[model samples]
Target: MNFLNLEIYLDYIKDNGYRCTPQRSSILSYFIGQKNRFVTAKSVTDHLQNKMGNVSSDTVYRNLHLFKDIGIIDLTFQDGESLFHLKNEINTHEYKFICTECGNTTDLNLCPMEKMDTALNDYLIYDHKFEVYGVCPSCL
Candidate 1:
């Protein structure tokens, strides 16, 4: 995915009825800089502390949740920590192999939902997320 401008993100926030504060802009800028990589809330908080002085983890997490809720970002869990990345495409299903040790991710070509379609014929499926977690080769 291409790097998006800060104003695009800020405009999305405004369109979603949220204020585009400097702190939130900074957070979005950080994610935009990260491109497709995932980051933890603690890392975002730490980065904000350096950039904006003493940002709380709670605030970072709240904004993260807001961004996720508004479809601006994607979320996954590794071990017990939450990880986030800017959504590469809106409303598109993504499958990934996530490295638990390093948080690196690689796209997966297979979609398990395709194989399960027969079993789920009676139920309507709206959305799904598939992630395989393990240490990457570099971590090994």
Candidate 2:
């Protein structure tokens, strides 16, 4: 992802009546640095601890959820862990099949909503998560 995408997120928070704090900026920067990959809050906290010297897990998790709420990131569960990844602009509706052993993710180009019951389309839908978990080829 281009570094310019950082500005897009900054603009989003600003539009939502929120100021970009040092921690928030750092957290977003860390995610941007990761490009397109699933990462854990603990991984982020460890990175911040190595770079900034002091950061709490709670702070990391809070900012992660905040980013998710603002549509900047998406979450998935794989093998008992919640992994996060940046939502790509081109494939916002794509879901993934995650490897339980290796944490590898393969994008499914179609939207899972198409599989939903027709009668349930009357209400609003804020978000959804659909992932298939199993061993990857290498792990087999």
Root-mean-square deviation per candidate: 2.2, 3.0
lDDT values, one for every candidate: 0.83, 0.76
> In model 2, what lDDT does residue 60 have?
87
Q: State the lDDT at 100 in candidate 2.
A: 71
Q: Ten-residue segment with the worst summed lDDT in candidate 2?
A: 86-95
Model 1 C-alpha lDDT per residue in residues 9-95, reported as the tens digit of each score: 788889989999888999988987875678989889999999999888889999999988887888987668788987665436778
Clashing pairs for model 1 are: none
Model 2 accuracy (lDDT, Cα): 0.76
Can you give the lDDT of residue 76 in candidate 2? 76
Q: TM-score of predicted model 2?
A: 0.78
